[model samples]
Target: MKSSRIQSFAAGVLIANSAPHLATAVTGRQHLTPLAGRGSGPKVNAVWAALNLVGGTLLLRASRRGGTERWDGDLIAFETGCLAFASWMAGSERWLRTNTARQE
Candidate 1:
């Protein structure tokens, strides 16, 4: 049990550290762009929005299965993060659309 707890702790730490890279990868893939290449902001934002929705769903499911009473904080954080990402994506898309309209 102790070893398992330690492993779980390590896993969490690793996940936290790797989140930025994962986010970038997901953003890139959603935009259909190379990881090292520049992608349209709107496209990336849309991808992020989609990913956040999906991630939020998954997190909620996990929370439910794990018993939310025990991990309420994590669940709340996940939900908040998803909302933040989605909102940012929406803003990005709106900005891009407006910019394009201006150019036209």
Candidate 2:
């Protein structure tokens, strides 16, 4: 019983931490800017977004494999950070695309 409880708690924590990453992934897919008229800004943002996506995917896989027994706070924090960054990048890309489209 105790072990199960602990497992549940760890899973909960992991899920909570990973939620932002999942959200970011969705946002990234939805808000990707076009390749055209990217200028310098979109290129930079794309790099960041790609990094974030990669990081998030890696962390998610780690979390799944690690499970409750191997849960690490640092990993969770890193994942959360990556997710937040990804979301910001996605938003930026979307904005740039919209503005560029309007100008053209």
Candidate 3:
């Protein structure tokens, strides 16, 4: 159960992380990614997004094998992870924009 919850949470984080990169990639824009850091271009971001999406899916499916004994707990943990990552992303993006504006 604990392992499953952890997997679920991690899966949520990875899945959430993929969305922004995927959206950026589709727009043919560059985005910072762990794989290529600040130099990540659209193609690189696309590949990074794919990797994260697939990895998260695999983790989520695996975690589900534990059954629904604690479904609610798992769901909450997963939601927390998703929300946490999303909030962090939004905050960081805003901070970066502000700092960049100041620099220019």
Best by TM-score: 3
The TM-score obtained by model 3 is 0.86
As a whole number from 0 to 100, the lDDT of residue 101 in candidate 3 is: 27
TM-score of each: 0.35, 0.30, 0.86
Q: Estimate every model's Cα lDDT from 0 to 1.
A: 0.44, 0.46, 0.85
**Deviation from native of the Cα of residue 25 in model 3, angstroms:** 0.8
On lDDT, the stronger of 1 and 2 is 2
Clash pairs (backbone) in predicted model 2: none
Task: Write model 1 residue lDDT over 1-104, tens digit each, in one string.
Answer: 33333333333333332343355455553232232234435455454445544554554454455343565355345444445555655686577642223454
Full-model lDDT, candidate 1:
0.44
| Alpha-carbon RMSD of each model | 9.7, 10.0, 2.5
RMSD (Cα, Å) of model 1: 9.7
Clashing pairs in 1: none
Model 1, poorest ten-residue lDDT window?
Answer: 29-38
Candidate 3 segments exceeding 4 Å error: 98-103
> Order the candidates by TM-score, highest first — what do you get?
3, 1, 2
